[model samples]
Target: MILYIEQEILLDTQCQDLYLCNNGLNNEYLLISSSNQCSCKKVQAIFCKYDHDSCKNRCLLEEHLLIKRKKQTNSILINDSPANVVLLNKNELEKNSEIVFICHENNLPSPILEHLKNLINDRSNATPNPSLHQTLIGNFLLKHSVLAQSAYGMYLKLQQTRDNKFQLRRHANIGYLLANILLGFLCSFILYRNFDLYQLISNEILIQTENLTTSIKSIIEWLMHAPAGLKLNQPLVDFLARFYFYHIYLWSGYLEVLVVTVVPYFYKILFILCLLGISLAIGAICDFIRLLTIHLYCFYIYAARLFNWQIRLLIILFRLFCGKKQNPLRNNRLDSHLCDIDQLFIVTLSFTIFLFLLPSIFMYYAVFTSIWTITILTVKLIQSMNQFLLQIPIYEFYLWSTGSGIIRGTPRLSINYADSTEDTVCYNFNFDPVSFITLYRVCNIRLSLFSLSFSKLFLGILKGKSIV
Candidate 1:
């Protein structure tokens, strides 16, 4: 195998030649080789050595003398040179190295300096040039550090700006949410009280009854004034009379009863009122809770967010329980405005303090009026039921009991004949006060229909046709 050996020549004084072997330590030889011939007298006093390891014994000169001779020859060539300019940057200053040529024609030209400029430019164009800028070389690696610091500063500023924007948005959302909750609370409170119940019941009874009566009266008077004299059934006349009397009496009696009984028993009445009162309060609270939830369904003009329909339904139901119609206003605006719970409480309190608060001396009489109205209605219902039983006669088996009677399902599964024999049965339904009101309302409707139908039939017979 053959080995490739490389060697380099440098102008250091201690060594003439330095050789590098791929697998061996460096070797120095004390032989001085030059391209030009050397004169013997020029560096003869300097000691010389020609110590190539192959010729170490043959040469007698010292290594330092040969190095000095070689350097002097190179110096002669450099000092005798006619280069006009030299590269003075780091490597060039140290080793007098060449750089790329720039022609004198490319700069200012003078004939006296032309030859020197050409020689300098030629030498500059040679290979193995030196760098002229030392500071740039020393500082090149620090560029990335400055850039990284600038980037980090910008990032911190952006982060702070984003955080501030987020805080502002959160604050605005909280304010809007709070405002909505307060508004819902106010609206729901108004819906709780039934301000229009009494007005509605009274107006409905008066208007409808008057219309019905006037229609009946017109028919009766027309028949009475007919050219031919007429006759009608006696029992039909009696039924008509009884029906008219009962409903009219009951209509008038309701006011007296509510005024006398409910005013005195204000605590019990207040309880009934508060049932809807606080329920609406709860609905308002539910709306507030729902506002915070992601679902926005409860917040709107026609919905729970604006006015909860559930509370309105409850108020209507409670009024029906108190024997009143769902609609109590002739004027639509009054119905909407006056039906609110805040209005109801105001009216109820005002009436309680001002109208119903007469002296105790007249208090018993007021209560007596309520009891008398109840007695009249009860008697009319019993009389109607008796008339019904006489006609239908199938429910004679229904046994009588107190207010605690079982009512919903089949209640008479096991009844002994001995316990069942009684001329009149008394069944009490007192659990819900509304049950009594509903019972009476049913009786009133039946009595009114029976009376109107019988009256029309009687008048038809009297006129011999077309009474309705």
Candidate 2:
């Protein structure tokens, strides 16, 4: 029997040709299997270090476990738990799904096994559950939502298993990516801080300030000796020069004074706070711009369908004649375009147009990109500080026995002889990290919506766009 394979064109050559069993008869199986393997050479190399059994067993095992976990996860009774798992992040979903691990415990008392299930059934409805973010860390021992939910699911599976509790724990990679990002951010900041970028900005501003001050002094001298008729005729230029000299002088000199004079004295307290605020504001502005641009891109895509006829016609015309076929490198007319355009031509055209129009965007883009990079460094530093210096334990439920309550012999369960430890109990666990991620994401979205509404209200009032 023949097999049919369907795939779209890839823009990059890095992940194109690498595959196992290039002409195997089991083409379907190969396709299914290879879908799970990393196409990137770098990722495969990383995978090879820990993946024994020639990566075959690991790849096969990953698919088998993920499928079983998905079945188990879907079979779960949503009505009983009613965990609202809202998935907004693509990375979180993929990463969390790949992290399903199985754990088993044998030789346990019946009550202990049963109690474990009960613990899983009960969620922490505690009032003081806190976020571990450095900006929002509280006094309470806050468990990460993913970890907490995983523990809960594991407890539930333990009760359902036939012999013993078999736990499926999905915590793949275990925050290594986030940790690496934090590390990289730190390294970049250390390198950048050594470069003294802020000193450069301050210095540049000082030089311009000095030059402008000198020019203003010359202008004033020229004006002092000039005729009243010429001064009247050039009153606008005189006013602007004087106004700019005072205004720009204050802005340029203040930072210089702060950095050159008072910063050494109050570096830790006042100056640092000022810098941090300025940095945060700049980062937030950059992020806002990025978000807005992305929103506009989405809007542009939808505008093809949603916009009025005149606008729609213009967009379609631009897209249709983008002329992907014009490239001599292209083999056929069917060869796809880059984002619906001829990449080489569009890029050159965009560069030309950017130079002529909206060049301010490019100027701000470079400055903000650097500032945001530093802000990310600050964020990483804060996250690391919280992780290292601050010890926030994951809150867990523990059982205690009372001295007054006397207990009889331990409870036991009779099973088949094949199942050894007949008078013993066992436990199974299944921890679905996805559920906790979804829950946290949902809460975060709600929080974001609330904050957005509040900010919009405040901004409207400030702009005199709404009720006082």
Candidate 3:
């Protein structure tokens, strides 16, 4: 069997012959070659020996070389003295490789070498291909419409205000921002034109606020008694229920007054927001809604604080019961302690009271927390929609779809082998349009209002930290 292997050799003026020797590994050979006598037959023999185990057919060997000459040397000459026999692994050969042009004359023509150098430099500095969306749209337009082709040609001749990718992105962002502002104005005008619709929306908001207050009051009353078939401390439940009821009553009264006085002028406030931008306007609306329902957030805060306080007291009392006290000098680590009888009695009493009251407090906390979370999520969804509108690249998408090269991304290089001769090679260079998807991925802010981990949120609530 015969084997095939590929290898690179470095040739210079001083080297002449080549030799192949096995390096005592599986199918690996070290080639020791000089410039003068390196030929096809010797390379094939080396390959056959390298793959002797698996192949019994003919072998093939191909060699590619790029050489560089010193400025002082004009002609190739063979050295009579033993050429330097430096053994190189693949990595060393790659590291020491240099590019040079071989010619029939002693020296290569300066024009040809300079042209090759220019090509290499141009290739290295060329822009990358356009984004995926741009390419797809560009191709579709180019394939189907002659009118699009003419328009694109005209667009290409027009001087570009945005000459680079960064400028293009900035221009697109400004366009989107202006578009959002215009949309906000349109929305505000529509609301202004339909006064009845605005009145209807205002009434609905007031109605929703009233309903929420009533639902919360009902929930508090139900919790005041035994809830979910669980026996709770009546005194503690009564205190919490009365506290929440008073706050809800105050909030409802405030809403009632606002409905009569402020609801009629709510569109004026929205029109002021619309002057800013659609995203800001929408975000303001969300904030306004949250403000109207602020009572729920207040209830959650009260319950969380009460629950957290009881839990902390219970933990300290538990440690005291276990005959341990936290030592301030030892970074608060628990240490063994013999408690006084009076202290022990107080600890036991406190722990029992806190433990009994915990269930009632916890139930309120959980209910209010869930409601607040849902409200926050709804607000975040609206805000995300606003953000999407503010960043969407509508203008760029239209330009790309019409085959306008103004939205070009990286320049693409294609080799035209059909145009190449023995003495010359040809290359074609064109710019691809930047994709909208790529821009969105890079520039769009994440839509989430809260990206907290579940464990972190749970711990925060337990510690009486406000999630908002």
Candidate 4:
């Protein structure tokens, strides 16, 4: 079934035996008297060269030619043309010979895979090399962001493949997200009944609804002093920031409720673990969900013109009821200064930039929890260990501040704070991961949004400075 693609044969890729090969690899130089496959001098000047780089280019050119031939004629030509194609051997290698494949080797045409089962499926059940797995998993995790991924996540990322599929696939994101969401709901239900023991000790004052409303009012008032010529949609900015805060506050409130209830020490520990898991799951789902939400928001904003009178009426009524200010840029067609499509594009770009810089809060929480718990236990062990272990601090904690420098920062997220008067700035690390997550989220969005001052002022509405 060897597809010695010497003659101009359109790849009726219906056959699995079809493969592309070149005569140049079998010889030091490739020569062609026929001009049907491009001119001989064109081949002599470049294609015939005994260089790996040149051969790669030649193979590409050959594939291109084959594709072109396929288009001109749909049938695979069976005549012998000019080729010294060798056998499909992986082991045979010349001093500088290399093979290039244009087709997807993992997934041949349906019938073809069946025919080449012996050749392709031979390594199906073979155990992957431990070192190779380690190398790949290590590189992938480090490349993405190590602080945001748990050890179990790392294991799944390194798991063996099925049906010879690639280790890297985009669909995995969808499944990972769905699993997290499902797990969150499951935990919520399970905790509701069997988990009555989460209450421990907490009497701290949580942010009240009245406080949130006051903050919003003050924030809007402070925006007037924002840099002039800023084109921010003040209402939108305030809304987004408030919404982000609300989500954080919701999670914090739940945690607060849990802390105030009474529970045993073992249940308390179990609750902490479950709490961390839920947070991590939420963090994992955030990226994809956020991306999706952004697009949906953009779609709504950009596609407002498509809405009939009923939807438009509802929106107008809702705005009136909520006391929303009339947007000067409102338009049924293009916006006052920006088209809907253009605005959507700009929104997407800004969101993408922000997302890239923001660290996963849940992942960070998991790591922090693990480290804090380990430190608590390890310190006790150190007290009994030899002098080497005794040298380390036990039953204590330390504090440090971050400066406005690239190499230094509290969360290491950013150094561009609104107030830069302080020589060194240290953020308070909250005992509650939820509260800390709130702070982290605020800092990241604020810094990132400000950094985009040169771009759109979409979120620059700060008529009041009293929000904090």
Model with the higher lDDT, candidate 2 or 4:
4
lDDT of 4: 0.30
**Please, what are the lDDT tens digits per residue for candidate 4 over residues 337-449?**
33356655655565454443222222222222333334333322332231111112111111112211111111111222431223222111111112223222211111010
Go through the candidates in order and give each one's C-alpha lDDT. 0.28, 0.29, 0.53, 0.30
lDDT of 3 by residue, 338-364 (tens): 889999999999899889888888899
Q: Which candidate comes out best when scored by TM-score? A: 3
Error of 1 at 36 (Å): 99
For model 4, what is the error of residue 181's alpha carbon versus the real structure, in angstroms, after optimal superposition?
17
> Residue by residue across 342-453, what tens digits does model 1's lDDT show?
6566545654443222222122222223333343344334434422321221111121123323211111112223312132111211111123332222111121111225
Clashes of each: 11, 11, 14, 12
Q: Write candidate 2's Cα lDDT for 1-468 as tens digits.
A: 111111221111122222321232321111112333323111121112121343445446544211110121211111122111111112221222211211112433222222233323222211122233333332121222222222222222222222222111111111222232344455445534554444554466467556745654564445434333332224433553365346545645554565465323332232232233222222233332333223222322222222233233343335434533334456433444555346556655654543342222222222223333344344334433323211111110000122111111122233223312322221121222233332222111111100124476445323223111
> Which stretches of model 1 miss by more than 4 angstroms?
1-188, 191-468
User: Which scores greater on TM-score, model 1 or model 4?
Assistant: 4
Shift of residue 266 alpha carbon in model 1, Å: 10
Error of 2 at 214 (Å): 14
